[model samples]
Each structure stands twice: as C-alpha cells, then as structure tokens.
Target: MSTAEAVPKMHKACVYDQPGTCSIAIRDVPTPKPGPNEVLIKLTHSGICHSDYAIMMNTWRQLPVPTQTGQIGGHEGLGHIVKLGEGSEKLGVKIGDRVGVKWVASACLACPPCTESLEGYCFNQKVSGYYTPGTFQEYVIGPANYVTPVPESLSGEVGAPMLCAGLTTWYVSKPTVPVLGAGLGRMIYRLPELTVTAVCELLIQNMINIICVILEYSALLKCGASPGQWVVISGAGGGLGTTAVSLAARGMGYRVIGIDMPGKKQDVLDSGAEHFIDVTQFDDATIGKEVKRLTGLGAKAVIVCANSNKAYGQAVSMLRFGGSLVCVGMPEGEQVSIANAYPSSMIMAGHNIVVSAVGNRREAIDVMEMAARGVVKFPVRTVSMSELQSVFEEMSQAKVTGRVVIDFSAA
Candidate 1:
C-alpha cells in the first residue's frame, strides 16, 4: 500500500448511537485499512444532508432497513487520499490526491444499472451512512474508481456539498441530447443515396447523443422548458433547493420562482430566484394561483426539493399545459402520492411527472466543474464533529438555511 503520512491506529467518528431518533455520540474507533482497489481518505469536511438526518431517525420508510446503532452517518465528504491499497494506482488515483465520497460509497460495476452509467441505482450498491461506515469520521475508505476527483481550485468546504445536493440538482438542470440511433437508422434506410461521409456524420451524432443521454437525465428537457422559461422550486431555501435554484437560474438561464417558509425568503432570492413565495402566507390553492399570476401561464417545471408531502401535492397545479413536475425530495414517514394529480386532469393538460435520484459519475464531475468555475455556489457554515446531533435537531425543525458542514480537522 502507498502511504503519504504516518497511519493512525484509531480515529474519531460521529455515530448514530441511538437509531430511530435525533441523537449521536462521538467516539474513538479503529481506523480501517483500505482493501484491494480502495483508498483510505482522511476526511476534512463532511456536509450534513437531510438524508443523513432521515437515516439517523429512521424516517425514510422506503429504505430496506433502519439505520443501525453506531453507524457513522454522513455522505457528502471531501478529503485527501492518505493510503492506497493494492492495484489502486491502476484506477488513476494516488495518495495525497483530493477526492470526494458521495451518497453511494461504492457500486458493483458489473451490475446492469452500473453498466448503463446509473451507478446510483446499482443493485449491489453500498450506501455510505445506512449500514456502511460513512463520512462523519476522521478516516473512511472508498472505491478508488468511484471517488470523485476534487478540483485543485475548489476548497474542501465548498466541494463537500457538491457530492450530493449540488450533483442532484445539476443532473436535472443540464441539457442532454435525445437518443438518435433509431432516427439515424431510419434515415439511412430511407435515403440509401446518402454518401458514406454523410452516414459517418450521422453515426458520430448518434454516439454523442447516446453518451450525453447516459450522462444526464435532464429534468429541464423532461419539463419541456427552454431558456428564459419560468420554473418553480419548492423548498428553495434548503441545501438542495438553493443549489437547484442557482443552477437553474444563473447557470441555465431559467426564470426561477422559489417557494419556502418566510425565514428562507432572502436566502432563496439571493440564490438567484427571480421571485420568492412564502409558504406560510399562502394556502396550497392560493400558492398555485400565485405561481400562475407571476408566470402568466403556469411554470414550465416545478421541482419539489422540500421533504414535505404538501409540496408534492401542490407541485402539479403550478405547472402549465404540457409542463412537468420533477420530484426530488423524499418526505419522511409514510409515502404518499402527489395530490391533485387526477388521471383525467393530467391527461387533459398533458403534464408529465419525473423522479430523479443522485446523479451518475459523469454528472458528478460535470457539476464539480461547474462549481470550480463559480457557476454555482453554496452558502455553508462549518461546525465541529461534536455538533452533529445539534445540527440534526436544527434540521428536524427546519432551521438550517443553507448547508451545515462538519469539519473533521478538529478531531
């Protein structure tokens, strides 16, 4: 194994001491050696995501099982590689290189989804915080190939949230080309007189089309929105919401309307939303009407980034004809279908509903590039590892404005 610094026998980790509740305890744990094709990272900053809280409290019913006691709970981690196991150098990573671990710690690259570039949905995926040891520790191990490379110019604090929140939002906002194989085949069959050069051009286009499609499941394309079209972001003040708002507005040229509680109004607006609606001031019906009022027609897309069932219930109503509702948030407890999405009404309006999870590896790199270029920025506050429990408490009460990152350097 290649090592850059003296290895430690133990490291400090924050764990969910009591599962099914908002509680945590920091303790000294034995540091683990990286196995084959893995690298040990000395985490510097780990962002606290709402999903981490859900795992700790066992609130997400869709998960196969509840979080276990003593499980380290964090996913958005940024750090430098301290040690590399055997054959890790073949993966193009080395000790002292900065990398970020995301929600999916690792995936069986042989799985069908992984082969299709959907590593997030791999059948044999290891989630970072649920059962596997996550990033809320001084040292963690990640697959050498899967860990994202951190840009030289981006700091660990800024790069941490991009692993999850920024990546998720950027995956949907980026444009992708439609698959063109079938179209190319039909053109070739119909126009046999086409020259060899023309056919080669078509094949090249098809290849680029497939590759781009695999890279991103473009939510804006699914919403049928063009640049300058209006889009609504529900829960636009939280970590994921704010990032989505900035990427959609400043990065993609969309006219954004952010919806959140009154406490988040300024943050939402500052994140680049053209308008902000306080959820406390308007009922569901009135809020939908207000969206229509501001948009002339309704919004071209409504992205629900809040973990409220009510946000999903009101999303479809805020869309124009043939518009789309992109569901990104996972509400706690029981799962409920989107209200007001009657089959007849949906059919009459030709509205579409799309669901997006964490993005593929290519999308992650793309979003990090965007972050490095200053196309998207996250408002973050750094907290010590000991404060994880308090941060979860604040998260449960909807008190966190942007993102809270746990600094492992203090350990």
Candidate 2:
C-alpha cells in the first residue's frame, strides 16, 4: 500500500459545547484518522435539518446512549475520500472518490434486524453525529463499505439532500430516531438512470404525495374519509403535511382543508387542498368550531402533522362522528398521550387514531416512479449553511413552506 502524505493535527468543526445552553460554537478540534477499512473524507457540502434541532437542544427523551459534548453534528454531507485505512482498497473505493454519508453510519449486519433486511432497526447501529462524530466538520471518517457512492455528474448541493431529506418527504419521522442521521458520510446512491434535474423535480413534487392507504385500509372503505368527504391536515405547510394535502385531494379525491399558520395558506392551496384553516387567526377553542362550521359538524378525517401534544388534542376535536384521526408526525418524546387522554365517551363515540411512519421500499419506488412520470409537483428551497440558525427558527415558528436544502459550500 502506498503511504499518504502527512495529515493535519486539527480541523475546524461545530461543537455542541453548551455555548449558551445547547447552542453551537465553531472550534478547531483534533482531526480523526481513518482506521482499518475506513476512509477519511473532505466534506464539500452538508444539509441543515430539523432533527439537528432535537440533537442540539436535547429535546428528545433520554436514550440508552446520548450524544456527548464536543461531538460534531451533521449527517447530509457531500464529500470525497482524502485518505484510506487498511483494507479500504479491497472495498472497491479509492482516494478522491466522491461519497455521501446518510442517517445510518454503520450497522452490525450480523444482528437479527440487519440479517432480516431491516438495517434501519439494527440494535447496534452507530448513527452519524450521534454515536460517532458526524459530517458537520470539514473532515470526517466513514466506513469503506457503508459510504454511498455519488455519480460523478452529481453536484454536492444536489446530492446533499438526496442522501436524506429527499427520501423523507413521505414519512412522519420522530425527531430523535436518526430521522436526521447518526453518521458522517456514505451514500447508497447509484441511480445513473435518474438525471439531476429529474431527481430535483421529482423530489419536490413527490413531497406533495401518502395516507390514503392507512385511511382506506384501516378505517374500512368509506368509513373514514372517501371521495367528496372533508379531510383536514394540521401543519399543512410543512413537509409531510403538504404531501398529505396533495395525496388526499388528488390521489384519494377527498376535499382537503389544510390547517396551518397564515403564511402557509398559499402553499397548502397549491398542494391541492380545497380549503385552508388559519389556526393562528382564531382562539384555540374557536378553531374547532370553525372547522365544524366549514365541514358540517367537523371533518370526516384529520391528519396531525404538527409535532406537538396540543396539535394531537386539536386534531381529536376536528374529527366528525365515527371519524378517524390519523397520527403521522411524532414529537420529541418516545410516546405522546393522546387517544386515551380524551374522555371514555369520546372514544366510545367512535373516534380512532392511526399511526404511519417511514415509507417502505415499495412506497419509495412508487413515489419516485410517479415523480419521474411528471405526475406530481412541489417547490424546494435552498439555504446557505450560514443561514442554518435562521432555518431552525423558521422551522420552530412554522413559517417556512415546502422543502429546504442546506448548501455546505456556503459554510
């Protein structure tokens, strides 16, 4: 093996050092060396995400293991290999190869979950930015076999979100489950069949597409919400909310009432909702009454996408008699008190909650296929790395619409 030149001792990284209580501070920390079958990467771009919020704020409940101080925090990194450790050459990778790291850094493939083709549920998974250091730094290490290989034609900015936020449009993710990521950099992307333009358009529009299956399959055909019935979506401006809006209207032929703060009205309407509910415009109690007034004694179904206990409570009130309340988005806590939080009479009156999370491989294939066929449309926004703090604030306020991507070169 040819020996590489001398490496740097330290590199610039964003450290989670309680810099004002769970705030971030950029520091020069010791650089990491690639060990056996590992590759050292020089990152070109990284995406900012909402899950980054859960990690930085520690809002999620205690885990069997929690992230430590001085750990770098970023998962959607686009970079190239700068150095390789022992045995890395045998993995079909080499120095200067472009790769991406996703939410899962490494998994113990010998575990039952991995063996069963459920690497996502691997008990011994080492998540980037969590268990191991992540790609928030300029240089990060990735396992040779796990890193995703990017097509040479793909740009770092476009490839960055493809590693994550791209596949995530349909799922209602729990903030802590590496819905963001656990590792530095590796990608499984090799779809040369898809052009960069086609992917961008598809990802954006496909974000505008699910939930018909859960509603129809679980609630009995037409028992939940069928064609010509009203289905309300809370948090309709955000990612999953918008997709629910689109699918409920166009895919299932339901009349969609999208409920969000005032700023999201246009995007919600564009997603194919028949109506928009400005939650901020009315008192919390009055909001339910307005929904009833518009949809005639409440909506036939309600999908909760806002990640809050109160949002779930509000969704319960928005449901009509014998209606279904679909719970999609999960808050920071492991379990939220809902269905039972209501009175027994309410439960007996026939209100039910249905939970749906990540989309499976089939779902992914279906969505992408539809997107490639030009069947969906959605808008995407790009943000500079320097604007990450504001991005979190926008998310916290629910002011942003559609999808957002992080451009690491801006860092």
Candidate 3:
C-alpha cells in the first residue's frame, strides 16, 4: 500500500489549556493531512525543553504572540516524513527522511526582522509550541523547507534536545563566532547520506557545544573579556546557565562563579564553574559583595538566568567596574528593566546590559555536529510523554537537574 493509504486518520496528542496552569489532556485528535508545501511526519521522539515549561506555565513576559488554547505544545521533535503535499517535493527533501523542528513554526518573510536577517524577532512569527500546533502529537505537520534534516548517526533522544535547548544556548544569542558550515552560504546544507559517523561534520562540523562554546567565545570577545577574567552566571545550575558555565570555564578559559540556590552548588561545580555562591545564604545587598570578594573585583560579566526581579537587581550590583550584565531570562510579572538606572548610577557603574533569545539556523547545524562528535555533552534524562505534567511540576519546583528528553516510543 502507498504511504498515504497506510496513514492513520487519528493520532494521539497532548493538549493543554489556560497557559498559566499546567493543564494537560491526552486525546486522539484527527491527523492532519499535509497541505501544499507541508510534510506529514510521524514523530517518534521529542525533547522536553525548558521553553516548553515556560510556555506551559505562562512564564515568559512576551511571546512572539499569545498562545492559542488547545495548541499542541512541543517543538523539539524527531521523526520521519511519511507523506508530502503538493510542491513539497520541490524542496529537495524526500519521503521517509528523518527531520526535526525548532521553536519557530513559520515567519512572515516580509517582516522587518526577516528582512534584516533576524527572523527570531519576525513581527509575524508563529511559535511552534505556542501560536501553532506543535510537535506533541504522534503525527505532526511541518514545512518542508523549514524542517531540519536529521543525520543518520544521531538518535531521536540525543538529537531531539538540540532542536530547542541546545540551539537556544549556542545559536540564538551568540552570532559572531562562526563554526562549521557557517561561511558556506545557504546554511541549509544538502543532506549528506547519513552513512558517516561524523554527524555535524559533513554539512556542519564539530561535536556538541559548538554553538555554546562559540557563542560564549563571541560574547566574551565582544565584551573584551580575556582569559582568567571572572564571569558570573546567576542561574548556573539551570539548563542554559549550566551551558554558559561550561563554555565560560572549560571552553573559554574564564574563571566562573555560579550563583544559584544552595541546592544547585554541586550541579554548578559539575558544570565546570570555578565557584558556587549560595544565593539563599545572602541578602540581596550581601550577595554582590560576596561575588566581588570571590572574584577580587566582581565579575567581568554577569549572565542572569534566574527569572526574578531580585536576580536582576543583584545582577547590576554583581558587576565590577565596567562590567556588563547580560539578561537571559524573562520572568513574568517581574521588573527587569534598568529603568531605575539614572545617568549617575549607569555612569558610575560603567556597565552594559544586553539580551539574546535564540540563534540563527546556521549555528544550529554547527552545534549538532559537535554533539554527534560526542564532545559536548549536556546531562540528559528521558521520560515518557505521559510524565510531562509531572516533569513540569518538578521543573516548577526547581527539581530537575538536567535536560529532559521524551522517549515517545510509548506516546
């Protein structure tokens, strides 16, 4: 029988409602047929990234737009193309090929952000897990041109996390550091036969942490950060925070201070942070002093990941003379602006602040190869899709220590 004929009319999907609450229901939604330029993918695995948690709990202050109710909420999916709609074949991707989707569902190419090569901020951006139906279903639909092709050597669970979490850490915010396949123009490389063991090396090169290390390297370079300079990562025990810790310490040769709750100390140490500061032990006034004492002059740069007003307040104080504060988290209902910064405070501080979200598609390719090379490894845990609710609960409680990937074989 033909692939289309064998396709099921109904597929299982995880549906959620009322974004603030983690409300989820597993139901059999009718499978959607591929539309023109779309491809039907039977997903076997998807990663449970913190972005998913942020959406589920309605934590982000700004989404590209508000999420729709009953939208299937997942993006880091790995699967095979089962059927293609009209004109999709022209994209050069074939049926039965493995592919992955990122947080961006689709963007209006005519938007100013797209015109300026910043599709991440496209004015009409449709988020995969928010505005549109995401990859939380057994069968998901994706644009043939936008879906990233999965290499043969990378497994579902292993490659799945790279789609969102890894990409966000390495690519989105860090654009200056060029890695493999960067200069090749048309970052979407022609799919190499999945025959080789060196995964990202073919179209993109290197192994895990490519994007993370390179981006950190770029950020440090941009800030005139030299080796042996002190860099503080406020959420050092969290996902992207841990990555920053690792890249700053191990990759960039920077002395790293990790600031988080007392419980995350060991996790910070494991991630290559030189020192861990227990934020709970110190009041806001004293926390910056401790960091200053530890670094002898405070950190050269402070990357804030804790989604709180206090963290942002402390981040400004945690900097040394001319130090920069980079905010990486968005806490809903919290004040993050340096609006309180008068000219005197900012002038006396001599510090700068910057914000970055996700990276370009080209960077994603570079990092995947590093992962396939088995070099940059993030701590990962596997869970069934049914456990998603519980997982989010643990995350909300600050209980999860590593990246969570869903083994959707049972989904």
Candidate 4:
C-alpha cells in the first residue's frame, strides 16, 4: 500500500447510538487498511441528507432491515486519499487526490444495472450509511474505480451536498435519451444476417433526426418538460428541494413554482424559483387550483422533493396534459402510493409517474461541473459534529433550510 503520510490507528466517527431515534454519539473507532483496489479517505466534510435521518429513525419502510446501533450515518462525503491499496494505482487514483463518496457507495460494474449505465440501482450496490459503513467518520474506505474526483475549484463544503442532493435533483429538469438498441437481441435472433455493429450504426444514423421527438416519448425523461415550461417543485425549501429548484430554474431554464411553508418562502425564492406557494395557507384542492391558475393550463411537470405523503398526493393534480410526476423524496413510515392518481384521469391526461434514485456516476460528475462553473450554488451551513442530533431534530420538523454540512475538521 502507498501512503501519503503517517497513518493513524484510530479515528473519530459519529454513530447512531440509539437507532430509530434522533440520537448521535461521537466515538473513536479503529481505522482499517484499504483492501485491494480500494483507497482510504480522510473525510473533511459530509452533508447531512434527509435520507440519513430516515435511516437513523428507521422510517423508510423499503429498507430491507433496520439500522443497527452504532452504525455510522452519512453518504455525501468529500475528502482526500490518505492511503492506496494494492493495484489501486492502476485505476489512476493516488494518495492526496480529492474524491467524494456518494449514496451508492460502491456498485459491481458487472451487474445488469451497471452495464446499462444505471449503477445507482445496481443489484449488488452498497449504500453508504445504510448497511455499509458510511462517511460520518474522519476516515473511510472507498473503491478506487468508483470514487468521484472532486474538481479543484469546488470547495469541499459545497461539493459534499452535490454528491447526494445535487446529484438526485440535477437530472430532473434535463432530458434523458433512451439507450439505443435496447432490445436489439430479439431482432437479431429473428434475422441472423444482421450483426450487432451494423445494426447499432444504422440505429444511430436513424435516431439523429428524431432525437427531439424521442425526448418527449422517452420514459427515462422522468420530468418531461422543456425549457421555459412550468415545473412545480413541492417541498422546495429543504435541502434536496432547494437544490432541485436551483437546478431546474437557473441551470435548465424552467420556470419553477416552489411549494412549502411560509417560513421557507425566502429560501425557496432565493434558490431561483419564480413563484412560491405557502402550503400552510392553502388546502390541497386550493394548491392544485392555484398551480393551474399560475401556470395557465397547469404545470408541465411536478417534482415532489418533500418526504411528506401529502405532497405526493397533491403532485399529480398539478400537471398539465401529458405531464409527468417525478418522485424524488422518500416518505417515512408505511409505504403509500400517489393518492390522487385515478386511472380514468391518468389515462385521459396521458400522465406519467416515475421515481428517481440518486443519479449515476456520470451525472454526479456533471453536477460537480455545474457547481464549479457557478451555475448552481448550495446555501450551506457548516456545523460541528456535536450539533448533529439537533440538526436531525430540525430536519424532522422541516425547519432547516437549504443544506447542512458537517465539517469534520472540527472533530
């Protein structure tokens, strides 16, 4: 193993001392050496996402198991490599290089999802701060090939949230092209003379002219709206919501309508939303009607970024004909489907409902580039390790605005 400096045997980490509650405790844990194709990172900052709070409180019902006691909890980590495992240099990562760990900590590249450029949903994925050891510590190990390189111009504090919140919301407003030749094997089986290479070349040539049409029809374009179209962002004042608002408005040219409590109005507007709706002042029916009135025929898309079940229930009603509802937030407690999605209305309106996981590695890099260019900026508040519990409490009450990042240097 290659080392940049003297390695320490122990490091400080924040752990969930009591799982299923908003409690955190700091402890000195033994640091381990990096295995083959891995590198040890000395984390400098970690963004506290609502997903982390969900894991800590055991609120997300979809998780296979409850979070164990003493588990470290954080996924959006930015740090520098301190040690490299055997053969890790082959991956072009070295000691002292800055990298970030994402929600999908590691994915087996040979998996079906990974092969299709959807590593975020890999079957063998290791989710940071879930069952896997996460980045709430001063030191953690990450796969050399999977770690995302941090741009020199992006500060660690700003880059930390981009790994999760920014990545998850960045792609909501952008268009996603469907993978070419998705079911070409079935066609080849029927016609043996057609080779894969020739078929791919023909498909590529034929697809060039219809790319714009495909964008409208592509199932992968979860938020199916073009530039200047109205897009409603529910829960648009929280960490994930604000980031989504900024990327949708400033980065992608969409007119954003942010919905949240009256307290979050300034933050939502500051994040670049053209209009803000205070949920406390309006009922679900009134909110839907207001959105329709503001957007003329209703919004072209609705992105539910809040974890509230009520937000999901009201989202479908705020869309125009052929509009999409991109679900990004994970609601706590029992799982529930979108409340207002009636089959009769959905079929007539040609509405689509899709859920988005944290983005793939390519999207992660793109979000970092967006931040580096100043096209998107996170309103961040840096806090010490001891303040983690209070942060979670505020997050649960929906009182926290923008993003809260933990500065490990303070630990």
Candidate 5:
C-alpha cells in the first residue's frame, strides 16, 4: 500500500557469488521493473529448499545459467504483488494479492511440453533461482502464466514450500486406480495400502528432526481416503515424507506405516503414522522380510520421495506383485538408469513403476488452502535470511531436521 517513494533505496538479498559460496549483502541494484504480462512481488518469506543448496554447491551440473556473475538463489517464494507491469491487466493479478513464484518461472507456450501442461520439463523454460533472479531478493518479477497465487487464508511462510517440494509430492503421491484383480485390485481393501522395505545408510549421525511441507491440509482431507488403507512413507520424518504421512493418515483416514530410523519413531507417530520402522538399523534383506510380514500381499503402491539409490532399490524389492512404485526423488550423483537387477521378475508379474518430477500445479491452490484452514500442519524452523550460508552447511552435513525457512523480514 505504500508509494514508491516510501520504499527503501536498496533491499538485502542472498546471492550465490560462485558455485559453493553464498553471501548476504545489501546491494544497490535498481528495483527490477516488471515486463509485459509480469508482476512485481515484495517477498516476505522463502523456503530454503535442498535443491537450492545443491545448485549453490554445484553438486549437480544440470542447472541453468542466466548470469555469468553471481545470481540470487531461492525458488519457494511467498509474497504480495505490490506493483503491476505493462499488460499485466490481462493476467488478472492485483496489488497486495498474495502469490508465489516457483522453479518453473515461465515456459514457452509454443513448446510441445507446454502444450501438454508438462512445463516441468519445458525445453525452453526459464527457472527461478537457476536461470533467473529468484526470491532471495526482496523484490522479484514473475511471469503471469506460471506464478502461483497464494490464498488469503495462509501465511506467506506456510505457503512458500508448496511451490516446490509440496508440489513434487502432490504429483507423486496421488492415488492411482489399479486394473481390477491386479496388485491393488487383489488387495480388496477399502483403504489405500502401501508396503516398502526402507534402508537408510548412516552417512551422518545426529538427532535430526523431521519436517513436513504442505500446501494445504484441508484439500487433502477431501480426497476421500478411508481407514484400513495402508500407506508407506519413507523419510517419514523429513519434510516431504512427513507431509505424506500426515495427509495419508490424519486427513485422508488411511493407516500410515512410517519408514525411517528408530529414533524418528516419536516424530513419525506425532505425524500420525500407525507404525514406524527403524530404517537406519536395518539391512535391505531384513526390510524386505519385514515388509512381507507386515502386509501379507505386499504394499499396493510405494511412493519414493527420498533421493537415494539404496531407497530406490529397496522400494522395488518391497513392492508386491502388480503394485506400483511412484518415483519422486532424483539421484544426487550421475543419473543412472533404473537397475534391471532388483525386480526383473516383478515387471513380468504385472508390477508398475512410475516417475513424477513435480506435482500437478492445478492442485496447488486447493492444497495450499488446506493449510490455511488448519486442516494440515507444516512443521518448519524459521531462520534469519542472514543465516542462509550456515543453513546450507547444515543441510550439506545432514544436521538439520525438518524444513528450514529463511525469514526475509530479518533483512
């Protein structure tokens, strides 16, 4: 509501000066003027995604480069639209309207992927925090077509993660109707059932907590899941895993069996998982045996939200005949083709394996609204924007439990 004259001359931003180095500084860059069909947002809070840390650390080489020099590094941004650019009227965006900017900033409408609403893989797409200046800065320019509108009910902080992590899971965890008499059809149970053998390698040892990121919990409540359906959630204490457990169990009325370390049992139970498996202490073979014992026919579907080769292999081994394995996590190292060795026989027996990179955006508005209504809870730790560098360090070391959000208001 304030005039341009009332705004500060310069705002603080966290910039990646080089691959592996991030610094917070007050820069005198001019306020970015919005382009045609674009709107300017004054961001309040942004979630520090693990992928952002990966990009900053140059852990992955596939990221886009929009600037040869340093660039801003954040994608999950929730803020208010404070200014309109030329031709923005056609976009239907308004001043003070809360909105979110995500990784997929804009996609060329002419692309084949765009035509199919598969903008996540749009060939000529621009990415925030990668190819474009992202939300780490106080003000950001967002394209009309791709930006997410935050509803009036949710706070900016709670709405931030939905643009990325939440969307990824929303896309992967959606229920599928298996062919009748197939793996899921054989179960003949009312509630959705999931079975998986979870194995976690102890790369780092600490009392790490789990955090779940949700767009909206109430929308998930309306999904019509019933009791007795079994849902297996790996990384059940982490952001994505916890959210899946909460929605699948608490909101949808499904029975949740959490897969994580034994120490994470309390947190997993707190998130509504009916059972917990201490994955760190178990071996792959042990997990498979345990899964078979827990679910007689095996799990109907397995949602792979953790990014590890071991997890993928375990997921494949744990699935029952004709069951589905939904791939959500990406490999941190070289992209490897799905191993043929694990369940070579399962495919022949009618098993289904599916991969989804990001959740459907059309569902985001509804999902975020659920959080606003207090139907779903997002557990997060608020950190000052100035602590971003250290946060990355903690993330790299696996010392953090749950999601770490950067409070830009501290700037």
Candidate 6:
C-alpha cells in the first residue's frame, strides 16, 4: 500500500498542561501536512527522555523556544515516512521508510556551525517538542534531510530511544575514544596532581573552581583524550547513561566502567560495560581506586550522565592527569560554579573539561546505524498512551527502571 494511504487521521498523543506536570489529554489536532523539503511521519512509538522532565518543569533555557501551555513533550520518536513533500526526493527520503526523529528539528545550513558540519552547536536551531512542535503526536512533521533512517530490523520501541538519548550520548563521548590512532599521538598525557578524594574534600570549600572552571572547561580543552583509553560513565542505569556505556564500549572500543545504583549493575554490564560499580556501596575513594586498580591508571575520560550537582562535581575526581571529563546532565536551579583557581589547578593537574549540548545529526546517524545493525541495544518499558500522567509521577519519584516508551498505536 502507498505509505500515505496507510496513515490514519486522529492518532493519539500525550500533551502537557503546564510546566513541571504532564497528563494525557485527547485533542482533535489535525494531522500535519508535510511542507516542501519536509516529510510526514506516522509515529509508532516515542521514548520519554530525562530532558522531557525539564520540559515538563519548564526550566531548560536552551529549548528552541519556551514551550507553550499544553505542549507535546517527546523528541525520541520512531515512525514510518508516509508522504514526502516536494523537494524531499532530492534528500533521498521515501515513503514506507522507517526513520527516527531526534531533538533537533531544524538548523539553518548557512550558519557557521552548520556550514562546518557542526549543527549540534548551531546558534540558530529549532528543537523538536520545543519550537516547531514535536513527535508526541501520532502523525508529525520532520525535515527530510535531517531525519535518520531506521532499519526495518530494529523495533519501533528500540528505535525511539536512539533518536535523541542514544544519539546525544554517542556524540558527546565519541571524541574521547580513539579511531585508527590518528589523533592522540600529537597530544601529551599528564596526571592530575590532586586525587579524586582530595578533590572531594575540597569540594565544599572550592565548589566553584573544581566543578566549573577546572573540571568543566579544562577537561574538554587540554586533556586530548583518545580512543583505547578508559572512560567511566556515571548514572549508567538511566537512558542516556545506558547509551554512553554501549557507545563507549561497543561502538568506540573503549574500556568502560558503568556506575549506578546496585540494582542497575547487571543492566550496565548488559549494555557492554566491561565493569560496573554501585555508587551507594562505594566511598569517595572507591571509584578512583577501582578505576586505577582495573587499568593501572584512572579514567582517561569521565562522562557525567547524572542530574545531581554532586555527580557533576565528583566526575573530575575520577579522572587521570591530563584526562577529560564530559558533563551532559544537570539539575534545575542548582548552580555549577567552578573556583577561581581552575586555570592554575588544571595546568598543574594537566586535564581538560567540556560541556556539550546534545544535537548532532552526523553522530545521530552514526549511532542509529549501530542500533539498526544490533550493535547497541536499548531496553525500554512500554505504557499505553493513556498512562502518561502516571508515568510522569513515576519519573518524579525516581521509580522508572529504564526508558519509558509510549505506544501510540494503543489509541
């Protein structure tokens, strides 16, 4: 059957009434018609991400624009292309094709970042669910050139998480892993003078210097971490955390230690981590000691996927001298202030830090291909479309076990 003929009107979606809360409200919104250079997606499943919580709370400053009241709140969606608007053919999009819709809904190619193929950092970008509307609806619109094609071999539920969480995590951590050994030969390796425990002790007093300037800025700049190095992923039980584990271990071939709660140890290991650590069982000395014990050195890179301010501060404590730490998640209203001595401390420590925003089409395509080939697996729990309100409550309570995907077809 023609893909358009297969799409039905009045599909189901979850809408949020206000920030910090969400519920399922049925609305008679029209099925969006694709525009030139656009494609209409008949969505099957959409995974709720941690950032969705921020959207629900109306706290994120980087949203394409402030979300309107009763806005739809999902970006990681999987669907089939039902119709291609005029000019979409040139982009190679076709009917009946499975595709993944991610956080970045649109970016102006003329911008310096976009021209350089760094669309994730584009100053002028629109986000799904924030600016141009989102994929929570049964039928949504997407850019033909921007969407990642999903393999038929992958399930819709699995494909859903790869769109945003998988792609973002992969993109953020990819630069740290070595590829054919081309990059790091020019870089110098230096160990930090202060240990993680020392950093922890000074954390309360030197909060601004250690977390913001030294750990956040220097790690991404001076460390020059490469592939084949050890990486530690914090908060490994959650959606983005799982993606970091799989991408670092399987995709990039880095030795990864996934750290989370004790109950998540097995899940972390299943995500291709070489080792796992339950944070509750460990003291400040545990992570660095274990990391050094396992690799004869501390982590070459640390990816912070936890939303707590403490996680962000402690991530640097796990790094080796000259290693890098990447910060991805943060809690609302919690300040991340690095102390004034960061430049000198980082110079003495010889490490770097980077704060990356999550929106990269090239890296998204790379990771999605990994998902399509079954190289990376994402575990998800499905809920009927009607249960979105309860799901939000569960999320607020930290009761969610894994990625939660809403099955729109249940409508």
Best TM-score among the predictions, by candidate number: 1
lDDT per residue (tens digit) for residues 1-411 in model 6: 244565566656667776655445756676777889999888888888878777877666644456677777788887888888999989988888888788877777779999866787778887788755777778888889888888788877777888877777776665422221222312222226656665555455544433444433233322244556788888888888887788777766678898888888878898888888878876765656776777786888888888766666667667788777777776655466632226777788777786666646656766676777776764578877677778777767665655788788764
lDDT of 3 at 185: 18
Clash counts for the predictions, in order = 0, 14, 12, 0, 17, 19
Candidate 6, run of 10 with poorest lDDT: 177-186
Give the TM-score of each candidate.
0.89, 0.65, 0.81, 0.89, 0.81, 0.82
| Model 1 residue 228 CA deviation in Å | 1.0
Cα RMSD of predicted structure 1: 5.7
Candidate 2 per-residue lDDT, tens place, 243-279, comes to 6676556544578898888878899999788889888
**Candidate 1 ranges with C-alpha deviation above 4 Å:** 1-3, 177-223
Deviating ranges (above 4 Å) for candidate 4:
1-3, 177-221
Model 3 Cα RMSD, Å? 7.6
lDDT of each: 0.86, 0.65, 0.72, 0.86, 0.66, 0.72
Q: Which portions of model 6 show Cα errors greater than 4 Å?
A: 1-3, 6-9, 61-66, 175-227, 283-290, 338-341
RMSD of each: 5.7, 10.0, 7.6, 7.6, 10.7, 10.5
Model 1 Cα lDDT, one tens digit per residue, 161-242: 9999988887666665431213443444546787878877776767766566567665235446666799999999999998
For 191-229, candidate 3 gives per-residue lDDT tens digits of 464445444454354323355555453423543355678
lDDT of 1: 0.86
Off by over 4 Å in 3: 1-6, 59-66, 172-175, 180-228, 250-253, 334-342
Residue 391 lDDT (model 3):
84
Task: Estimate candidate 3's alpha-carbon lDDT, on a 0 to 1 scale.
Answer: 0.72
Residue-by-residue lDDT tens digits, candidate 5, 176-210: 22111112323434234433321122111111211
Please provide the root mean square deviation of candidate 5 (C-alpha atoms, Å). Answer: 10.7
